[model samples]
Target: MSAPRPPAPPAKASGLRRHRALLARLAGGPAPEAVILGDSLAAGWPGPDLEAATGCPTLNLGLPGDRVQTTRWRLAALAAFAIRPRLAVTMVGTNSFADGDGETRVIAGLAALLAALRAAWAPPVIVLATVPWRESPPGRSEADRLALNAALADLADREALLLLDCDAALGPDHAAGLEADRLHLNACGYAALSGALAALVRGA
Candidate 1:
């Protein structure tokens, strides 16, 4: 009989490695034409599909467990690189919710992040409203998410940013588009999101 497998590394350790790898890739490669930045959704995005769908060389700067404040902090690292992305897609804020932040704080954090991205890259920013997540997360409610999205939309308008209502793409029934965890997207959901984003990228 085999010995019990070693316990897995702490998630924070694994996340650090992933961040380091992404940074090295960004620092070494050709400048990306488009970038997807935010939280896990940004990290989990099918880069090849997005590139294929949008006809852009894309970079994914998403980090798991990233809140709006975390994204704001990470922006400085991306800005340190010489690259200037023509377009940026952001899908964050859910982690902020999960962190027990109220709607006002989450919106403020998002505003700050958008400000930093604009200052750093001077690109057209596409901000996707926070996606629906499962009840297990235990910090946000459907009503709160909708309110957050509405606030984000208003902010986008004032900031002259493009706000994509991801809920619509995910469909009226949220669970159908989500994975077993009911937080992340399934293939069909991703396809729908990518298709919606392709149109915006073309317009940009």
Candidate 2:
């Protein structure tokens, strides 16, 4: 079967309107010490947990159903606010796999997203979290996920970005940390992820 097409970009006017309040806050609010970007996983991360982990304010810019292209668009909109963060973390690409995108395309997309992030925020340090495990969807498998993550590691090295392996954070018993659908993280998963992320930020 042909690979499923990537997600289409949202209309500019509506997209901007949807995030207007957030943009306003980013523009006006005190600069966050760290900013998290990506899809639902990023959005669902508890703010309290993150703050407690990093010992500072953090802004999460994750949106449900976001793909690499759409995320790039979000970054473009956010550029206007000039939100300067000390550290940035991103966890995306599972949705792309669900969309049936191949590893090459996903990696290229991530590289672009990383470039956009650096150009826009220029954070002192950037963290690229490996795509977490999920139940094998049609046209995807565990092997595919591992291959993509391996590529991501190389990408991080090439880009000089720190790579955070989600599996390592979740530990060997990661299944316990996943939701029933096995796609998104449960509270336990988030706890471990946030703790690892915070440690990285502190050390970076």
Candidate 3:
């Protein structure tokens, strides 16, 4: 068989247009104390919940369907903003798997994103969340997910970033926290995540 197809390139035009207002506000307003970055999971996280959890203004820069590459591009835009967040949380890479990327590429992309984030935001604390469990695509299995998480742990250690295990926060019955599609988190899942994140922010 031919090599698996690569993921579609990010729809930069539409994505940037959609987020233009939010970016402007972020650039114009008082800087947020924390910023969350990722795909749908990060986008859907309630702002009130995050503010309560972190006890500070938090900006969610999540874009649905973003891969690591997409997030890296998105981060470049934030460079124009004079925002200096105290903390930054990232929950990306799952979309990469859905789009047929393997462990090595995903890890490399994540590392690059981290480097870019540091250069752009210079946050005192950076949190790298483990990709949550999800339904495996064809030719992938739970073992692959575990391996990716393990690699993420190594990446976090090497980069001096805190690692949050989303699966552990969701607990052994993680499926209950997942939505019907089994890919994204539901209310219960977000609650768990918010609580865990609060604890981390307090300590950080």
Model 1: lDDT of residue 52:
74
lDDT of 1 by residue, 12-49 (tens): 77766777788899988889988888778777878777
In model 2, state the lDDT of residue 161: 88
- Model 3 residue pairs with clashes: none
| Alpha-carbon RMSD of each model | 8.4, 3.3, 3.4
Compose the digit string of candidate 2's lDDT tens values, residues 32-148: 888888877887888999777667789888777777777777788887767778888888888888877888888888887888888888997889989888888898889999998
Candidate 3 residues lying further than 4 Å off, grouped into runs, are 1-9, 12-14
| Highest lDDT scorer | 3
Q: What TM-score, computed on C-alpha atoms, does each candidate reach? A: 0.88, 0.89, 0.91
lDDT of 3 by residue, 1-204 (tens): 123223343576767675676687786778889999888889888888878877888988888878888887777777778678889999888887777777788888888788878888799899999988898977788998898899889998999988888988899998898899998989899899888888877887
Clashes of each: 0, 0, 0
